[model samples]
Target: MGDVIPAPEAPRIPIIDNDEAAARRFPVRRIYCVGRNFADHAREMGAAAPAGKADRGLPTFFLKPADTIVVDGQVPYPPGTTELHHEVELVVALGADAPPGELAPERAGALVYGYALGLDLTRRDLQAAAKAKGLPWDTGKSFDFAAPVGALVPAAALGDLAGRSIALAVNGEIRQHASLDDLIWSVPEILHELSKLYALRAGDLVFMGTPAGVGPLRPGDSFQATLDGLPPLSGRILPALA
Candidate 1:
């Protein structure tokens, strides 16, 4: 018989709605994200920093490691900045591995395992500073506790959400409201494009992108996000570390 090898440790995250069980059922690999995938949001960031001439066409991309996920836990306000912002988004979790190639839109839907409400916490000040210097925003975007995800609802239950409404509220005020159809690039296109760059595997998550109207947050502030017919997911903002 061949020599025995130990199994690898599981990546930990707060799992709700049998996600842990589901995760065991379907192993996850990595996380991919598309930046400024909405026209309004693109305009907002573009207006903040004009990229050469006019800003039009093509969305930016970014990545967040899988281990950064924190679910229903205290989000420690990262050090080095006071301008921490929140960008709520609809998260797509993949179920099976897809080879890097031209993935048809239909095949794209086949990869989805479930959906979740997630927060793309950002260090706005650092992000702006990086943008001014033409640097990557990973410092602001990929920090620990930067991604907080909620329970997963199986794709079968939600069906196709291409045109569903997604909204987020702070305290009681609506901060963001838009249909998934508003996305500059559809989910399938995103998956296909991403697949070309990276092989997507089961458990991989993609935070499609956020809409306009992103702003700062502070301790004691609570927020809620909802996607169409799914139940709302809520979390409180934490103060900056001293």
Candidate 2:
């Protein structure tokens, strides 16, 4: 038997519309992440990402608690790590529950509520150590304020997301840069694959993976990220608490 106590409350993030009016605070139910979904990024990691019509490697995934999300330019430099990395990505929030079974790519848009620019902050050293030991790396990716995001833009207000550039800059210097076209799997394909494995529902946020240049972070460091069709997301790395 487990401890006799009430369950803890799940954290929530405010969803403001980048286009116009603000959105209601979305109760985060779950966070799904896609890993190494870019060819060049894969190569940089010393492996090749599956591609072509015949390539059918199972999609890599991970999860973070909703409490990890932080917004409004306030990202804290977490403790217990010397190497903190920033990964710029397009965050997808689902509007409706995905139908159980294999979902076709055509219907993926119907399930999307909006999009946003998110930084998947990682403790690269801890993550690498975990990988070396064949252990779960959630400790590296799911730390406090690990997901710093910007406003959510309604899907209808956007056009083609592909071919657009997504980049990150630190202290006014560009670090990571890539086009949306570099994604190994499209948003629709990711949604389709996720639905087959997990129970997809409204308020679910999916981190669509990062591009090649993943580097370190320091206290008081400023980070600015821009996804071509989405609003720019910026934040500062706060000093670790005493």
Best by lDDT: 2
Off by over 4 Å in 2: 1-23, 51-53
Candidate 1 per-residue lDDT, tens place, 111-170, comes to 887888888889999999998999987888888778877777778878878679988888
TM per candidate comes to 0.85, 0.91
Off by over 4 Å in 1: 1-9, 12-28, 47-57
In model 1, which residue pairs have backbone atoms overlapping below 3 Å? 28-203
Candidate 2 residue lDDT tens string, 43-99: 787877676636847668899888888877787788889999998888998889988
